[model samples]
Target: MDDVSSDKHPDRGGTRRILLAGPRSFCAGVERAIEIVERALQAHGAPVYVRKQIVHNISVVEDLAARGAVFVEELDEVPDGATVVFSAHGVSPAVREEAARRGLDVLDGTCPLVSKVHAKARRFADRGDTVVFVGHAGHEEVEGTLGEAPESMVLVETAEDVRRLTPEDAERVSYLTQTTLAVDETTEVLGALRERFPLLHEPPSEDICYATTNRQLALDAVVAESDLVLVVGSANSSNSVRLVELSQRQGTPAKLIDRAAEIRTEWLEGVRTVGLTAGASAPPALVDEVVAALGELGPVEVEERRITDETMHFELPSALRGTAGSRTSGGQS
Candidate 1:
C-alpha cells in the first residue's frame, strides 16, 4: 500500500485538503456479518465455509480467508455436515433448502434490513399483487429477493423498464427494492411507476439501508466543495460505485479505488481540495492508509464533514453469540 511516490506529483506541491465523510465505512450489518465469520472460526475451528463474499469488500473477504473462512459460490463446495455461514445478502429459500438437505451447520449472516425486504416480497406476492422489484440485474441481493416470489415478481432497472411493464393486472401491483441503490435514481423510477400505475402499492418504509443513505448524505456535504472525489471500495460493491456516480452526477470528477496505490497522479494535477469517503463495506484502515499516502506527497489537511451520527448496531447470529471473542462495538467491528 506504500506505493504512493512524491516524485509522481512534484508539480502539485501544496497543502492538499481532504474532506472525510462521516458514517462512511463498515455499517452495522457489515460488522455483524464479519463478526459471525470470526466467531464461527473460534467456535467451530478453521475451514468454516461461507456461501458468498460475505460482504462486497475484497479486503474483508481476504482477511476472513486468511483467518480460516473458506468462501464458496455454492453449497456443493463444502463437505456435508460442515459449518457454513450465509453472506450478509440474504439467500433464497431454495438455497436454504439445499443447505438443510446437506445437513450443514448453518449460521445466517443476512442483514436484518435485507431480511425485511425479503419478507415484504413474500407478503406482497401472497396477496396476489405483482411485485415490482427495483435494483440492478445479476446482483446477488436482487437475485435473492426476487427468488422469494419469482412467479409473482418482475424486475425493472430504470424508468423505461417501468414504462414497458405489462403485468397481468396493472392495478394489482406492489413494489420493493434492493437494499443498496442510488436514492435519487430510485425516486425517479418510483415517480415513473406512479405515473403508469396510480395504485402501485409501495413498501411500508424505504428499502435502501441506513448506512448506504448516511454515506451518500455525508458525501453530498463535501463533494461540491471538492476539486476531486475518491471513493474507496472494490468495483463490485454497488454502494461504493454509487458514491462515485453521485459525485460525477454533481459535475465533480470522481474515481473509485480500492486502495491508495490505485490513485493516479493526473487526478491530483491542479487539485487542492479532495473529498474522501469509503463504501459501507470498506474497512476504515484503508481510508487511513489513503490519507497517509496523500500526506507523503505533500501536506494534507483532513476535515471530517459529518451530516449525521450513525449509532445503528446489529446483533450477531445466535449460534455464535456466546462464543469467545464475540464482543461488539459501537463503531466498525
Candidate 2:
C-alpha cells in the first residue's frame, strides 16, 4: 500500500482516509467498444444508430449520444441500410440475422471474451452436451449467450437453480458463466453443480473475465480496511453490483453509485475510512470525481491497494482498423 495525501482541509477537524482499489474502471473490452463507436462516428458522421448502449455506463452512453450516436432497443427502430454497432455485451445470432435481412451495415463491438463464451456454447451444443450457463436471467450478455443454443442451454442464477435443473442427458453436462460475476458466489454455485453432477465438464479456461476477477480481488482487500465501500458504476452493471454485495457479505457497508452526485451524505456520516472502486464499464473520471467529493467533506488521505497489474488489450474490429483515433485519457487498467 502506498499512501498519497491530498492537501489538508482547513475547515474540517479530522482527516478521512480513502483506500482506492487498483485495476478499477474501464477494462480493455470497454475501451475497445467505446473506441469502435468513436471511430464509427468519425468515419460515418452523426446519426450512427447503435443497437444498444455500447457499454452499460451512463456516462459513456451519454457521451456517445452527445456525439450523435442514436441508441435503439432493437433493429426495428433503425432505418433500413443505416450502419449499426452492437453493444459490448454480445448480441444473439437472431439479431445478426435481423440486421442482415434489413441490409443494415453492421459493426460488431462484442467483447472478445464474451464471443469466446458464445463459441463454447455452440461447441457444447454440437457435441450433444447440455450447457448449464451460470448467469443472471435478464442480463444482455446472458440473453445473448442463451440465444446461441437456447434449446440446449439452461440458465441458473443460483445453486438452488442448479438443484432444479434436470438435463435430458445428466451425464453429458457442461458449464459456462457470465464474464462479470462475483468470484466467491460463483464458486459456491459451481460447488453445488459439482455435487449434483460429479462428471460436470468445465470450460477449458475460466469464463469470468480477468478484469472482473481483478476488481473483485482488489476490492476484497480494500473492503477489509474500509468503514464504507463506494463502488462507481451504473445499477445495470453486474460486476459493479457484485462489488457492493461482496462488501456487505464481508460484514462491511457498501453502496453502488453511478457518479459522485449520487453519493448520499448520510453514507459518510461516521465513515472514517472509505473504499473506492469503479466497474469495468465505468469511466475512470468518475472515480476521480468521487475522491474529490470525499475531500470536500474533510481532509482525505488516499492509499492505493494494488493486488495485480492488468495489461490486457483487445484490438478494434478489422473494419475499424487503422482508423482509430487517440486513446481515451484515463488508462484502461
Candidate 2 lDDT, tens digit per residue, 1-333? 112232322223478888999989999999999888889888889989998788889998888898899999999999999999999999999999999999999999999999999999999999999999999989999999999999999999999999999999889999999999999999999999999999999999999999999999999889877778999999999999999999999988999999899989988876778899999999898899999888898789888999988899998988889784865535432
TM-score of each predicted structure versus truth: 0.94, 0.94
User: Per-model C-alpha lDDT, please?
Assistant: 0.89, 0.90
Off by more than 4 A, model 1: 1-13, 326-333
C-alpha displacement of 252 in model 1, angstroms? Answer: 0.6
Residue pairs with colliding backbones in model 1 are none
Displacement of residue 54 (Cα, Å) in model 1 is 0.6
User: Model 2: which ten-residue window has the lowest total lDDT?
Assistant: 1-10
Across 150-208, the per-residue lDDT of candidate 1 in tens digits comes to 99999999999999999999999999988889999899999999999999899889999
